[model samples]
Target: MIFQNRSRCRENKSIFRAGNQVLQHTHEYTYLGLKLSSTGNFNLAVNELKAKAMRVFYMIKNTIRHEIPIQTWLKILQAIIEPIALYGSEIWGPLKTQDFSKWKKEAIETLHTQICKSILKVNRATPNNSCRAELGQHPLLINIQKRAVKFYQHLKRSDPSSYQAEALRCQEQNRPRSTLSQLMLKLQPDQHSTIWPNQIIQLQKLNDITYWKDATKSQKKMELYLNLKRDYKPAEYLSCVKEHKVRKTLTRYRLSAHCLAVERGRHRQRWQPRERDCVCVCVCVCVCVCVCVCVCVCVCERERERVSECPLSGCRERTAPAEVAAERERLCVCVCVCVCVCVCVCVCVCVCV
Candidate 1:
């Protein structure tokens, strides 16, 4: 018995109906066989069962479905199905007993080998080609390379435990090597610092040597502070040198020392006061004072002139000069004559009485 293909049968209703009828008949016959098996029709029952099994097989064949790909399925199925196929007979037998420990050990070993091989393959396949041809040709690369060599030598001398023997061996073998500067140029900015600190130091040293020649006095001082700060943490180094009690004193000393140096440098250099500025301030003050003095003098002169021009006697009308003089003399003489008359009257009265 064969099941009809869905695609081929879809276009023909008669074919689809015929396939459905066949499936129904197979189910009915299989059910009838189960019902009749208790009766004496054992041969007929066996034939019906075979027919139903054939129908199920045909259905599966025509399905063409997959959960896993064929290759993966074969590999996985070999592990699962092989054991079961080999042990199926023993598994059902009353005398046979299962041993899971042996099977588990075999499976673990197989998985471990597979995992290790996969990791090694992945590691081997990673590309290590560099894109630093231009960097290799740089002029500074040689100097940086020398410095890196020296730094590595220092590291080896200072602490052999910290330096990897393999890396040091590689450096010794590869002489006339390109400096880390070239390598750093190929790396990201953040990666450069972590990858090549010694190279960075050499580059900075080169810059400083050049800067010392051309930098101004103030710039040199600033560079000194920057270098110190870069090499040592300000708070930690200061704390180490001076205890808490003397921290402020140390800080003041440092600040005063720097300030004095700056002041001394300024003193050594020629610095003239701005003449225009000084003259402007002096002229402004002089103009203000002169204006105030002129105003005061004018006020005093005006008051003096007003007082000198004021008439003294309010009763005097317009009078001739000679008449004024004669009146003045007559008034004086009359005052004298009255005083004598009073005196004589008093004497005569006294004598006659």
Candidate 2:
């Protein structure tokens, strides 16, 4: 008898139900170390895998041999990181969306920026491809693809009378290529779609007798893909380098902008008070913004994504070199009020007693 280890992350009885009724229902269950959600998406499993990989990577990095050779570290990664991160990858590998924007950025970011770069003793400035190449480690995405291809091959090679082969046949009838057609298309060396025509033909035959059996094709394809001459695609290479540059530039820009904003906010907070002040001299400056008859409503729209930025957008203080300041006398220690209104907006004025 086989025993499956139950995980603490197993799905629990439903706390909610439709039609304003509560029913004892379990939307998901854990079996064989996999978290299968009701939606049938690998999101939960993928998140778990990432958490496991990160924990294992850190554990090995610090607790174990402190100063291991790069090659040894690579071996350690393949042993621990791969098993954790790539478990059940064949099922959900191709299910990933092409758009990285919607992905859980933290999961991939930690893997790429921290684990992968630290493994190679490299920094974020290094190109992604260069980092993987220098480390002699396969890209996480590549390994997942290879697993998918292998699994497809296994399903094709299964017993003809088995349900697995029957399911493969059903999948073939529904689509010309496997579900991963788009993923494979992206991995194609050229922009042409017909490059993998033979693979497509075999997918059509998935329902029939498993005649096509070039099991090592995925490996060959990956090796060729990696070894392809990049000199021919100078523009693509430049674009990749430019992508890195853009990301770095954006990071620096955001940092400087954030620092300036924080400084301005601190200055504003220091000058301003929490309690409302009474302005005895309230100057109502209205610049006759299109006086309409019976309809005094005015519409003035400005496109600003971050309109709440500091120094107050409408009240930009500009003092030219030729401009002279008016002579002023210091007031005695007495209660006073100051109000200056401009551009149809009241400036918050305050005077200390």
Once superposed on the true structure, which residue ranges of model 2 sit more than 4 Å away at CA? 1-23, 98-113, 121-130, 176-353
TM-score of 2: 0.44
Instruction: Give the count of colliding residue pairs in each prediction.
Output: 0, 0
Summarize candidate 2's per-residue lDDT along 1-353 as a digit string, tens digits: 11224556655543766688876655566767778776566678878888888888887778865455555667777787888888887777878743332332535434744575675443454344334433433335545666676676688679999998998788767654566555554554354534444464344334111211222223332233234422212223323433544533433332222234432354354443333233222322222122221122211111122232333556545431221221111111111122112322433222221
Worst 10 residues of 2 by lDDT: 326-335
Q: Clashing residue pairs, candidate 2?
A: none
In order of appearance, the predictions have TM-scores of 0.21, 0.44
| Residues 1-353, model 1: lDDT tens digits | 22243243333233325654633212123342242322223334433433443344336435646332223433432454323322211111111111222321333223322222221122221111100110111122223333444454454566455556555556546633522222333322464234455566556445433443343234433433333332211234332543433543443333223234443455466653677555655565555556556655655565445444446334344343564456545644654565455456545543432
Best by TM-score: 2
Per-residue lDDT value at 339 in model 1: 49
